[model samples]
Target: MKRTLSLILLTIALGACSTQKPANDPALVGTWKGLRTQTDKCQFLSWTTHLKPDGRFTITFFRDVQQTQAIQTEQGTWSAVNGKNELRTDGVRMPDVYTYQLVDADTVRYVSVAAGPSGDCQEDYAFTERRLR
Candidate 1:
């Protein structure tokens, strides 16, 4: 019986080690505004991206630093990848994969990796963002 109990405890310990840390469910169903560091020409873009719970997203770019003048807009969908550590976006001009981490309750840092068709062009962008609402 003692041997059986030890085996059971060992199994339980191994199972515990395989579990992941639980986190509060973060909802991206709102607008997020931030500075996106671009690498194509090395510039910062003022952006407001909208997200929905249904995985739909819209990105708006601003020409002014104050984020008042709208320059362009694009729509896409976002999905979680690599066990939620990364985000994959589709239906956009840049179709990118972004790896991100939460810095705090209201902030997150994201790194997006992009590649061109010829396979010779690749770029990465780092974005510092805050939840707006």
Candidate 2:
């Protein structure tokens, strides 16, 4: 009886260690599009972001709200940290943190907390993005 109990405990411990943790913010693992207006100028910037389940992301930026002209594209990785989202792009030194919340079933809001190397126009910026269906 003593040997059987020890074996059972060991098996249970090993099984627990082998279990995988859930992915970070699984609901944000899709394509999202939004338009952010510049605070100091009459500029409307349109962006489309694709967040993968593998913690990778790609964002394409356009100058107009209609997204007819492509400006640039950036690749990065993102993760959820302390109820906020942290995005780290390639060639950037620091990560950009944002407060993310769900606006509706298909829409989400992201407010910038800290600016990074992504060429943000100003501070105190917020944008609403809809998940591409």
Candidate 2, backbone clash total: 0
Cα error, residue 87 of model 2, in Å, equals: 0.7
> What lDDT tens digits, residue by residue, belong to model 2 across residues 1-133?
9999999999999999888544678778899999987665547789999989899999999998888899999998898744589889988998888899987768988888888865666477778899998
Error of 1 at 69 (Å): 1.5
Q: Which digits, one per residue and each the tens of the lDDT, describe model 1 over residues 55-75? A: 677878886679888877867
**Among all candidates shown, the one with the greatest TM-score:** 2
Global local distance difference test of model 1: 0.63
lDDT of model 2 at position 72:
94
Q: What is the alpha-carbon RMSD of candidate 1 to the true structure?
A: 7.8
Distance (Å) between predicted and true CA of 11, model 1?
31
Q: Residue 93's C-alpha lDDT in candidate 1?
A: 49
For each candidate in turn, the TM-score is 0.61, 0.78
TM-score for predicted model 1 compared with the true structure: 0.61
What TM value does model 2 have? 0.78
